[model samples]
Target: MDGLHAPASLALGIVPRKAPALDIASIPRFWFDNDPFKTRFFDALSLLFPEGEKFFIACVRDYRANITDPELQQQVKDFIYQEGQHGALHTAFNDRLKAQGVQVDRILAKQRTIMFDGFRGKLPKRYTLGQTAAAEHITAIMAHRFTHSDVFASAHPVARALFAWHAVEEIEHKAVAFDVLRTVAKGNWLIRAGSMLQVSVTFPLHVVLLMNHLLKLDGVLPNPQVWKDGRRWLLGAEGLLRPMLRDYLDYYRFGFHPNNHGNLAKIQRWREEFAEHGDARLATDRTLHG
Candidate 1:
């Protein structure tokens, strides 16, 4: 593969200097309108463990300093915008939990101090690029899972909408990270191999910990009913994993292309949903009886 042909992974398009606008109000409402269980799940997880957002912000900040391509820089900026919106929305959700008497500030504080403070210095450009590539690949698979599974089907309409919307964006920018990595670190098979391995290990670990934390916070950690419901929701989702990892592994096999396998039609569908019901209320009447 000609290294020059490697499209900028961070490039959203050929457009230059476009600032990313986030619909923040559209975010927390989606979370609130989603399934009560899932909302509680995400809320508890976000409040107790805020490291994911810190990691995302750190990666984006690193890319800002490291990526040279103008178009790629814009895409990275868009990504940072989306991630920042997610963090802000989740923080609000965490606040709601605290208002309801959930003590999560200490947990989040510890994570912020440990993770964000630890990564304050500049990172190696190549390693940063590789990490971004790996993260994008993992998020792409998660987007697919969100779309394909019934995990969010019975969720509150707005919650389902939020996850669906986030998934579509993930699909939209899925190639940016890989494109950037290939552009800056071409011919480095070791970096590619190492990224793939790290992704394989970390994705599952993160999910497991998130789930465990949620269960513990909900007082369902020892409940067999919770396991049964969770098992049913997760059983068929394994199929989403292999294809993503396959793509990650095969990234170097041919010319790296951005228009690879993204679901544009699905993205359009999400746009329609957003236009139709984006005005939904931030609070829902749903209860977590399930």
Candidate 2:
């Protein structure tokens, strides 16, 4: 219950709800506002989620039996369920990309080889948990920004529903990994801070590189207009990336906790929205293969 607010309690059902079906085929290549750059940008993030969330689940579940608080223990179970559902959903989405002949498998293969397999044995447990805590902060803030902003307003309905739902859950259990870290790793501030620094560099670098790779595959990387629009999409007044920069800085503050951001009202609203429309199918008409 360290970071659980009243609204977040609803997310701790102990069983993870399956994500509503998303019509991955209907999601156009440039799904975000119909802009290729923006679409590719989000695709870059999606590429990371399956593998990344798996690592996060492992980091927290490693210390599951040690969590003494009943509320937190239940939250951890929900967290694992949520993250597992995320990985499965994103995997289905990525499969659609591959069927569309997008070069996504190359990126995913690299992720498996480099991130999942390569780093699995090399990193220490404390470091891994610290990294999980730091990554959760990043995703949680991104969730807040996604929910509050109009960034996804013009996105394809399929992508919008998927992201909006994911964001809500991200906000719901935003503190689970950090709580696990606090309990298991003794909340080592130095390791936590260092992991953030590492994440700040590697996370963005990986996304940008993947975006560029996807764009290059699509023959849009060298186009001047693409970069111009992409820059504004990320850094402009209504840009999604720039505003979150401040949120990212909040992690460096001493005694930072994700609940400090406080989005209960937003969570409540989204919870209602999900309860009403959360079960919508992703792409029932089309068959997807794993």
Return the top candidate by TM-score. 2
lDDT, candidates in the order shown: 0.52, 0.74
Candidate 1 Cα RMSD after full superposition onto the native fold (Å): 7.4
Q: Which stretches of candidate 1 lie over 4 Å from their true place?
A: 1-51, 63-68, 100-103, 117-125, 148-151, 185-187, 236-259, 272-290
Q: Please give the range of 10 consecutive residues that has the lowest summed lDDT in model 2.
A: 281-290
> What lDDT does candidate 1 reach at residue 27?
42
Clashing pairs in 1: 9-176, 9-179, 9-180, 34-156, 34-159, 35-156
TM for candidate 1 is: 0.67
Off by over 4 Å in 2: 1-15, 280-290
Using lDDT, give the best candidate's number: 2
lDDT of 2 by residue, 1-290 (tens): 21222223233233367877767678877788777788888888888999899889888877888878998888988898899999888888888778766777777778877766665678877788888899998998787777664557677778777777777778778888887887666867888899999988999899989888788888876888887877887889867767677668878888777776734555565565456655432221111100
Q: Evaluate model 1: give its lDDT.
A: 0.52
Error of 2 at 88 (Å): 1.0
